[model samples]
Target: MTDFLNILLRFFHFSSLLLLTGCLTYLMLLTPAGYRNRLEIRLSPALRSSAGVALFSAIALFALQTVMMSGEITALSQPDIWSAVAGTRFGHAWLPEMLLAAVSFMLLRAGGEAARYLLLVTLILQLILTAMTGHAAMHDGWRGVAGEVSQSLHVLAAAFWCGGLYPLLLLMQQGQRDPQDNTAVLTMMKFSRYGHWAVALVILSGVSNTLLISGIPRHFSFWLTGVLVKSVLVAGMVMLALLNRYWLVPRFRQSPAESRRRFIRLTQAEMGLALGAIAVVSLFATLSPG
Candidate 1:
């Protein structure tokens, strides 16, 4: 069914988006934080490979979605479809994503303090741009630009909060890969502080976004259900973030063993929830702006 397939695409899109967001956080935030902790990160060969692969995967998926959505409207198909991509609104929207992804790849491959700093800045920018492409910023002219700014802040913050999940999960799975190794613990502390800052920004941006999108005049009934779903999911994400900061980080810093296991379990769940939220976001983006 076209409907089912559309939903499925959205599901995959969201999953991919969440993973991409997390990757951004990992590459930008978690990795650097590890260095700051004075723990020599094993930037193992596999880790470097993943950096390239992840960048390519995110770019490919986003491009695919743009082309597919544009294909139905235009007559472009197959090899010619790329031109359709270059000429469409979706294509225009995709330009920044492609550019950022390119930068991400280049920086990731370079691998140094300078490259890491650039990567973090780029990740923060991409998250903001991604949010701007959504319905919330589709209106409001000058105000809309401000909306994008707030939105960028919101997305960057959320990505940092949620994206840290994978890196933390990996650390947990290895379970005291080095108990005395203060690197993981130090990294965790940095992220804990960063996560709190992100939460505050998320709350502020959320209020701004809600006010902009929903008002007395525009009764956006179509989006009501999806918005509610997003709200609940965001609440859950905040809870997980809190747990990571208040409960897990301190425990892990101390009980290294139990902390590792609990962190892994929670992160796995967090990943699923993030994916589900992405699905909702993709669907919401597709709907007509009411």
Candidate 2:
């Protein structure tokens, strides 16, 4: 059962991550644009529905993971008074997930950007605080707070760019259904700009995280490996983003149909990288790297 539980946690963690990508992408980028009549015409309702389900599954799976990770797997079988989703470490984490979950439901039902923005804020808060409860922050002094913030930013930024790739790729695959949709390129630029911001913070925060850990020269092997892995992922994402913005995106803008297709492929690839990074993150979260 312990093995099964581990498997369950891993599966749910990855699934929630995929959903989280959509949730963050939709709320931060797509939601507002969608409200302003900016979405492509061929983005079929089916695609939107799948995104919603993905987001919903992410929250539910996360809640379950929280239950298990919080060391409450056995408690889950206890009476609702103690074992409930609202009464454990899972509950603390669930607060934001639950709120964001509601936001996704509303977005689907009401169909607007306001819901998206609200959801984005909630997701950010949840993610930010989520890292704080971990050993990285709670175990250290004042400096740890900054480390925590960076780690959270790192994750959030990764989700924004990485998760956004799915929908972006999907949009691209739609084949420039709207020849005049400049928003596609605009969104690409937006992600590039955001990627720059994520990178800056990632570097600064990474330094702080290094300080908390045994330094590069000291633990050059395993300790540095953790940070190095994340750095490589961030670097790759940044390069892809740069190419998308300056190179492919410009060429794409000149040709609507082709640009959409390119964006879709890029988004798919971005998501794959983001998932790989997160898988590494999950292991790091479970271990004491130093």
Query: How do the predictions measure up, each by TM-score?
Result: 0.74, 0.70
Give one digit per residue, the lDDT tens place, for model 2 in 80-130.
534455665545655665566556555545555576566556556656655
Ten contiguous residues minimizing lDDT sum, candidate 2: 35-44
- Each candidate: RMSD to true structure? 4.4, 4.7
Whole-model lDDT values for every prediction:
0.62, 0.57
TM-score of decoy 2: 0.70
- Backbone clash pairs for candidate 1 read 128-152
- Candidate 1 lDDT, tens digit per residue, 89-137? 5556566766876786677667567766776666555565566567667
How many pairs collide in each candidate, listed in order? 1, 3
Off by over 4 Å in 2: 1-74, 79-113, 213-217, 220-226, 253-263
Runs in model 1 deviating more than 4 A are 1-74, 77-90, 216-220, 248-256
